[model samples]
Target: GQAASSLGSDGSGYGLAKALKHSVTCIVPALVQLKVKAHPFAKASGVRTEAKVTALIDGKEAASDTGEVQITAYGISGIPVFQISRFIALGLHQKKRSEVLLDLLPEYSEDEVYRLLVKMGDKRDDLTAKGWLTGIFNQKLVPRILEMAGVRIQTRVSELRKSQLQAVAKKCKRIILPIQDTNGFENAQVCAGGVRTKEVCPRTMESLRTKGVYITGELLDVDGICGGFNLQWAWATGCIAGKASVMRKKK
Candidate 1:
């Protein structure tokens, strides 16, 4: 009788009603705040400058003397030309120099690439010579690569001789675009240059110069091509630094 009566009681029903009301009241305002913050720059244009960054780590003094800074729409701040901010930060902490060299294209051999283009032309005689490259490369990139190779887009594929094909292929693959400079710190998500890896222990990420100083993340002279490789490197180095720090504390 008591169990049956409890099911019909208003007390239990009131408690459930109160819980639901409280949940919605708390959740709705929080959601509204998040949405407002997420679109802070919905109407904003251009870049915002950030405060000058300077730090001292492990007895090393590092500063952004250029006083240059920039922030992105997502609230992330960095410099454009120095995309290696993470590495710079790490180096400053470890008292090391930060430097980076970027090679725009690392995969292709110039001579071999040229040969492939030459072969493509010979193989596809029926297609418009200029349009023959549509299968091998993006339409947008075809013209650029051809220009670098000194090949005319209008030339018939059938007209391409072995030597010409070789030249085109070489240019497509070995188009050397030198990195004059990287986007500075404001636009850069991480620093390309940092403490030399040779001086730091890869296993632990501990600095050789200072026993208690641990270097990790973008601070080391290791970079991966675009996509998530840089973030992966950070995660890996962070783990190594954390473990090493723990080990040092244990001793």
Candidate 2:
């Protein structure tokens, strides 16, 4: 007996296998790549791009750069900072910028971050701080570290100066926004651009555009964020489409 099979998806065919002559819908998971940008230290000089920074003077935007500041590294869906860092790093090709500006750290208020750094300085030796910083930061740049930590000048500490603080502030004020590649299927766990859902009947996974044709799984332009959602979508849609296709033969 001859058997007819409808292809929903394969491990890697979700994107390329949309060539079915019948009424077809494609399900591509949304693939998001980490945006990449140059590290702060990688800049040739102090030329400033107006858009890249929050310009926080006292937890508020500086007078020069205006508009709302975006904070990254904040939790997504109740995920903690440590966990979010993992994703961010993965997106960034494991190349985390060594100098993260203070404003980017959303967990602490501006004042609290400065006080914490001061306290850290008090408890630890400055040489030890420099040594410790060298490990995590690029080029052993102390001023940049201080600026990232939101530390300015301390009258009590004779070693730190106003000019060095200003330099650090300038360098640490901005981070380049990462650029995402047009296609992220290679790195993405799920593909994004699929058949537009509007064309498919949600109830039966049948093509509203073409009669009696069915679509299901990752072929129907349905994708969800990480978790079991994509799998669930595949299971549910596949079942509905399969049942509908079978029932159509009897009619």
Reference-based lDDT, each prediction: 0.44, 0.41
Candidate 2: deviation at residue 118, Å?
Answer: 1.6
Question: Over 4 Å off in model 2, which ranges?
Answer: 1-35, 39-104, 123-158, 161-174, 180-183
Using all chains and alpha carbons, the TM-scores for the candidates as numbered come to: 0.38, 0.51
Error of 2 at 54 (Å): 14
Clashes of each: 31, 14
Error of 1 at 149 (Å): 1.7
* Residue 10 in candidate 2, Cα distance off native in Å: 9.8
Tens digits of per-residue lDDT, candidate 1, 18-129, equal: 3333111110000000011232232332433322333223333333222223323332233422333443434433445433211112245656555555555666667555
Model 1 weakest 10-residue run by lDDT: 26-35
Q: Per-residue CA lDDT of candidate 2, range 102-171, in tens?
A: 2333344445544544454454434443443343333334444454445432323335454543433343
Indicate which candidate wins on lDDT. Answer: 1
